[model samples]
Target: MLSLIVSNPLFGVVLTLGVYFAAQKLQEKTNFALLNPLLISSIFIIILLSVTNIDYDSFNKGGSFLTMLIGPATVALAIPLYKNLALLKKHYRVILVSTLSGVIAHAILIGLFTFILNLSPEMIATMIPKSVTTAIAIDISNQLGGITTLTISVVIVTGILGAALAPILNKFFKINNPIAQGLALGTSAHAVGTSKAVEMGEMEGTMSSLALIITGITTVLLAPVTQAIIHSLYF
Candidate 1:
C-alpha cells in the first residue's frame, strides 16, 4: 500500500503542495525570515521521504512533472517585466551593467573560492552556476561535466540563503534603489529571492524578475568561458 501510493505521480504533487502550504502558513504566523516556505517545505519533504524509506528516484517520478513547470514559471516572470516595461526602458543601462556584473562576479567568486579551497574540477564546475535557477543551472552543470545533483543542491542553498538574508543585506548596505535591490536579490538568489522582492514592492518584483531572466542568459553564455578559465588555472 505504501509503495503503491508513493508510486503514483500525484503523490509527489500532493505531497509537495501540502508541505509547502503548511510551511507558508507557518511563515505567515511567525513572520520570520528564517521560516522561509521553500526552505521549510524542502526540509519537511526530505525528512518525510527519509523516514518513509522512499528513494529520490521514486519521489522524482512525480516530482519531474513539477520540474517541467519550471520553464513556464520562468517565462511567467516576464509578466512583471512587461508590466514595468517603461521603468525597465528608463534604467536599461543600469540593469544591463548590474546583471552582467553580478553574473560574472558570481561565477568568478565561486571559482576563486573553490580553487582556494582546492576542490575538484567537477566540484568547481557545479558551484559555478549556483546562483542561476535550477533548470538553467542543471543544464550548465551537465554541459560543463559537473555533478547535476551537487549543482542543484548548491542552487537551492544559494536561493534559500539569498531569500533569507536579502532584506538584512539591503538594509545593512543602505541600498535604497528598488532596481538595485531587485537586481541584487534576483541575481544572487534566483526564484526564491524574487519572492522576497515581490513583497518589497511591485517595481522591485518586476526588476527582480527581469534580473532573473537576464542573469540566467548571462550565466549560460559565460559558463563556458568561466569553465575554460577555471580549467586553465586548476586543471
Candidate 2:
C-alpha cells in the first residue's frame, strides 16, 4: 500500500495533507510549541526520504503539484497588502527606514563576512538575498550572478534560524510593539516569520503581511546596489 501510494504522482500531495491534518489534531491535544505541525511534517518527510533512499528529485516529482500552490499563495499575500495600504501610508517613512535598514544590514554582513572568509564570490552574491523569501531570493541571486542552489540553502538556513530565535531576540531587544515584531520576523524569516507573527496576534500578522511585500520590493531594489558595494569592497 505504501509503495503503491508513493509511486503515484499525487501521493505526495495526499500524504502531506494527511500529515498536516494529523499534526494539527495532535497539536490541539498536546498544545506543545515544539511539536508544531510544520516541524512534525518536515521531520516525517525528512526521515521518509532518508530511510527510503528517495532523493529530492523523486519526491518532488510526486509533490510538485502541491508545491505549485506556492505561486497562488504568494499572490494571495497581495490582498492583505492592499487592505493595509492606508495604514502603511501613514507610517510610510518609518516603514521604509526600518526595512531598508534591516535588508541592507543583512546584505553587508553576509557579503563582508563571506568575502573576508574567502568564500566564493557566487556564495556572497547568493547570500545577499537570503533575508527574503526563497522565490525572491532565487530571482535576486540569478540577477546578481549567484548560484541558485546556494541561495536556496542559505535562505532556508536564514528562515529557520530567524524563526527559532525571533522570540528571544524580541525580548532581548525589548521590541514589544506589533509593528516592530512583525517587521523583524518578516525581514528575517520571510513566510516562516510571518507565520510566527500571525500567532503573536492580528496586529502582528497585519504588519507581517505588509513587511512581506515591502521587504521583497526593498530587496529587489537593493540587490544591485548591494552587489556593487560588495564587488568594490571584496574585489
Candidate 3:
C-alpha cells in the first residue's frame, strides 16, 4: 500500500493538499502559530520528495492539478475586487503608484542582484519575472529568453516564501495599514501571499488583488524595456 502510494504520479500533490487541509483544521482547533498550513504542507511535501526516489516531473504530473487551479483562483479574486470598487475608486492613486513602485522595484532589485553576482544571462532571464504569479511569469520568461522550468520554480518559491514570512515582516516593519500591507504581499509574493493577506482582512485582500492585477500589467509592459536595457548592458 505504501509503495503504491509512493509510486503514484500525483502522490506529492495529493499529499501536499491533504497536509494543507489538515493544517487548516488544526488552525481551527487551536490558535497556534506552529499550525500554519503552508508550512506544514511544505514540510510534508519536502519529506516525501526527499525520501522517495521519485523525480519532480513525475510528482508534478499529479501535483499540476493543484497548480492549474491557480489561474481560476486568481480570476476569482475579481469578485472581491468588484465588490470593493467604491474603496478602490477612493484610493486609486495609492493603489496605482504603490503597485507601479512594487513592479519597478521587483525588476530592478532582481536584475541588480543578478548583475552584481555576475550570473549567467540565462539565469538572469529566468529570474526576471520572479515577482509575478506562475502563469504570467512562465509566459514572460519564455518571451525574455529565460528557461521556463527555472522561471516556474522561482515563481513557486517566491510565492511560498513570501506567504510564509509576510506576517512577521509586516509587523516588524510596522505596516499596519491595509493598503500597504496588501500591496506588499501582492507585489512581492503574488497569489499565495495574497491568499494569506485576504485572510488577514477584507481591505488587505482587496488591495492585494488590485496589486496582483496591476503588477501583472506593469511587469508585462516593463519586460521588453527591461530586456532591452539588460541586453545593452550585458551584450
Candidate 4:
C-alpha cells in the first residue's frame, strides 16, 4: 500500500508542492537566509525518497510536469523586464556587457576548476551550465551527453549559494549599484538569486530578471561551442 501510493505521479507532485510550501512558510517565519525554499525542499524530498526507497523514475513521472512549467515560468519573468523598459534602455550596453562577461567567466571558471581537479569529460560538461536555470541547463546537459540529474543538482546548489551569499559578497565588494547587484546575482544564480534580488528593490529585481533571461540565451547558444572545446581539450 505504501509503495502503491508512492508510485502514483500525483503523489510526487503533492510531495514536491507540500515540501516547498512548508519550506516557504518556515522561511517566512524565520527570515533566515539559509532556509531557502529550494534548498530546503530539495533536501526534504531527497530524504523522503531515500527513506521510502522510492526510485527517481517514479518521482520524475510527476516531477517532469513541474519541469515542463519552467519554460513558461521563465517567460513570465519578462513582465518585470517590461515594467522597467526605460531603465533597461538607458543602461542597455552595461547590461549586455556585464551579462555576457559574467556568463563567459562562469563557464570558463567551471571548466578551469574541473580540469584542474581532473574531472571526467562528462562531469565537466554537466557543470558547464550549472549557473543557469534548471530548464535550460538540463537541455544543454542532455545535448552534451552529460547527466541531467547532476546538472540540476549543481544548478540548484549554485543558485542557493548565490542567493544566500549575495548580500555579504555585495557589501564586501562594495557593490552598491542596483544594476550591478542585479546583474551579478542573476548571471551567477539564475531564478533563485532573482528572488533575493526582488527583496532588495524593484529595479534590482527587474535587472535580475533580465539578466536571467539573457544569461539563459547566452548559455544555450554557447553550449555546443563549449562542448566542442571541452572535447578537444579533455576527451
Question: By lDDT, who's the top model here?
Answer: 4
| Lowest-sum lDDT 10-residue window in model 3 | 31-40
| Candidate 2 weakest lDDT stretch, 10 residues | 31-40
| By lDDT: ranked, best first | 4, 1, 3, 2
Model 3, residue pairs in steric clash: 10-62
* lDDT by candidate, in order shown: 0.87, 0.79, 0.79, 0.87
Which residue runs does candidate 1 get wrong by more than 4 Å? none
Query: Any runs in candidate 2 off by more than 4 Å, and if so which?
Result: 1-4, 20-40, 145-150
Rank list by TM-score: 4, 1, 2, 3
Model 1 compared with the native: what TM-score?
A: 0.91
RMSD of 3: 3.4
CA lDDT of 5 in candidate 3?
A: 73
- Candidate 4 accuracy as TM-score: 0.92
7-95 per-residue lDDT for model 3 (tens digits):
68668677777888997798669855445566567667768677876667777877878878867865775676688789779998998
Candidate 4 residue lDDT tens string, 67-90: 889778767867867877887799
lDDT of 3 at 233: 79
Native-to-model Cα distance after best TM-score fit, residue 79 in candidate 4, in Å: 4.1
The candidate maximizing TM-score is: 4
